[model samples]
Target: MSKSFNAYILESRDKPLIIMAELIRKALIVRFQDKRDKMKNYVGRICPNIQKKIEGLKELSNQCIPKWAFDNLFEVKCHGEKNIVNLVAYTCTCRKWDLTGIPCKHAISAIFFKHEVVKDYVSHWYTEDTYMRAYKYIIYPIYAG
Candidate 1:
């Protein structure tokens, strides 16, 4: 991302401008606004990739059998193996959730068992609010002298 930003800055510097810094700021604002607009109507807090993971969890939830294991933990039986899921910790014994910031099937099941919202369990980094905050600032172009 930094590389791309640097490249953009270099490209902008090559152009004739009364104030290079102001031009670069305006360009960045436009770029960020475009990206933010695309994500403005997102269905939920998580990104598309994490949303795909959640879809997979829905399918897996149907196949797995869940047993309550005290607190926010659950023991899920899938494909003849028992995997532990701790909803509070946002972890699965399978290690998928720990490795990736997204929650795994077992954890999703545990969340379902507790009647909780899956989006609530997702990492805050994937939230729509966070995405909006990333591009919250707007930069207006300065008048060319």
Candidate 2:
């Protein structure tokens, strides 16, 4: 994807100065607009992958049983297996959350048990604020001499 994008940019730069500036400006504007629309649509929402994970978690929460452990920890049982969840550490015995930076169903059930916001447990990288911050810079058009 990046290779194709870089190639397009390189080709654009080789065009006549007036056309090059216009092409680059249009490309940047389209990209910026797309990102802005995405950010607007997902305001107060987590990343798309995490959203799907949360949906999976909602279903799992119904099937799993949660027992409180020490502070911020839980023991969840599903399908005859026990998985430990530590809310403070954002980890699960299955290690899915630790490996993927997204909460697993067991952890989600634990959070539901405690009546906490599941989105809070999600990583900041998945937050809308972080997405917007990544694209906050304006791409200015350079005047062709």
Highest lDDT: give the candidate number: 2
User: Candidate 2 lDDT, tens digit per residue, 1-145?
Assistant: 5897787688697789988878878898778878878778774578776687788878977889999988898999999999999999999999998987778889989998998889888888888788788878888766569
Candidate 1 per-residue lDDT, tens place, 19-112, comes to: 6777688788889989789788677668776788799888887778889979888899988989999887888889988887677777777778
Q: Per-prediction TM-score, please?
A: 0.70, 0.73
Residue 64 of model 1: what lDDT? Answer: 80
> Model 1 segments beyond 4 Å from truth?
1-30, 138-145
Model 2 bad stretches (over 4 Å): 1-29
TM-score of decoy 2: 0.73
